[model samples]
Target chain A: MIDPALGSLGAQIVLAASSDENHPPENIIDGNTETFWMSTGMFPQEFIIRFAESMKIALVTMHCYNVKTLKIEKSISDDATDFEAISEKEFEHTEGHLQTNDIPLNGTTATHLRFIVTSGYDHFVSVHRVSVE
Target chain B: MVKLRSRCLLVGDAAVGKSALSQMFRSDGAHFQKNYSMTAGVELVVKSVNIPETSDSVELYIFDSAGRETFVEACEKLWGQPSVLCLVFDVSSELSFSSCGRWLERVRAHCQGLHIPGVLVGNKSDLSSRREVETSVAQEWAQSQGLQYHETSAKEMENCEAPFLSLAQLFHALYQDRLQTIQNLA
Candidate 1:
């Protein structure tokens, strides 16, 4: 059986706004919802995920907690720059459980994806898992 | 740049200069309050220490608890699993120095045997004429407990920064080790 999660396809988080000892950026691509990358504090936290090669991504799923507003951008070049806005969503508040949302990417081809949390419902937020289909 | 934050619990008997030492380090040895009304509750002092030879830094949130036993019982609830410890005592008072064992025991019990690296600080070193605790004895005890020992005079702002700096560095070292472990897991 083949897993559809991009994490299983060797996606890696190359840049994160905050790198906490306990909750690291690596956790975002660990393919386990139980493990998560937590923001230390403040707003406008962002992370960039790099793929082995540019692939057609139609849908993106996220399991997050306490995140209010999120924006996504995609870059096809070798560098992480020259990105274009793909999708934006205002997540509902969740307590005791993760707020899971599936975002449509319209099958865009990209080598890197940037997820930015513009704000949070609380002082801190956690991104449990990011998968693409 | 691999920034980290840690909680440092400052504890000892009352009037042992825990506040003075933290204040001195926070202000870079600038202010030493001459007349201090004993801290009645838990006082929090935050300081940022840059680790040597690295761009990484550790933001130390120092919880300076009241020395009196009654307040300590209440302060214990606020500690919230301290990452490091700073056990202080007055070198001029043997009784205060003796209380070090009790404080250590209490912290050990509270942490449930978790190994939190720390330092043993002998404050009030300026009172050499009235000193009751010897450096050799304190050094031996600290070694037995696996803690680094340092003597400081908070009154004169002498060596007041060493213990806190050591604690920050110790925490930073721990973070580095953990970072390596996480990276290897990838």
Candidate 2:
């Protein structure tokens, strides 16, 4: 079972709303909790992850820090366009550790998944890692 | 082939030529505006400086914040754990020179007492006749504060790069010390 196989399956953040040299978007799929992709102090930040091939996804789990609301979307097309909303969550604030969440997708199949950070506990938010199973 | 990026902050009292010094260094002394407006918030400018005798370079993301007391509170949110500092003061204004301690305290407080490498700059050296802050006095204060001091004339575009270059070197030296410690641990 490739339980956390986003990075190993060749998924990458093809698009990001904000970019910081120190906290590049690639950290989201690096599968390392120590490194995270951080926002440069603004809201409505988003990043789109594209898998190498279309696959069945039963659940989407992630580790986030200071994130308040997160919305997940999926696209079946070849490109990362025309996304349909799957779920949105208001995270519980945590201190000294990340807020872990697993949103069930129920056997959804897609090539691209987009994660939108609508708001955050602080001015900036960090998405540590995301996995699909 | 080492590329490092760091956050650098410019803080001081108003009209101390912080913006002018930043522009001069960014443009390589080619552009010094005759009539410059005050910075209301934070302005970011990224520049790369190569370390001498090494292929490594540090990309300095300079956050030029407004010098006015009213705007400083809001500007702190944008600073975001600064790695280096450029404390500026006008040479002709004794009041501004005396406020250096306050500015330094604010920066250190925001950093949560981390060791931030930095340089103290006395701008407006062209106003030598009207200078109220002497080189010896400024140097002495900088030494007491554990910072190296340099004076520059932003209007005349002279000695503008010295302070920033010095800051880059200091950051590089700190990185070397950390690398050495890790190597010894290994």
Q: TM-score for all predictions?
A: 0.65, 0.64
Candidate 1 residue-wise lDDT at B178: 42
What C-alpha lDDT do the candidate models reach, one value each? 0.83, 0.83
Question: Candidate 2 chain B: minimum summed lDDT over ten consecutive residues — where?
Answer: B177-186
Off by over 4 Å in 2: A3-49, A56-77, A81-132, B112-115, B143-146, B171-186
Mind giving the per-residue lDDT tens digits that candidate 1 earns over B1-186?
657666788999999999999999999989898897798888999888888888778788898999998788888888766678999999999999899999998787755455788999999999999999999999999999988999999888899889988987887776565434333333
Model 2, position A59: C-alpha lDDT score: 92
TM-score of 1: 0.65
RMSD of each: 9.7, 6.2
Interface RMSD score of candidate 1: 8.6
In candidate 2, residue B123 scores what lDDT? 96
Docking class of 1: incorrect
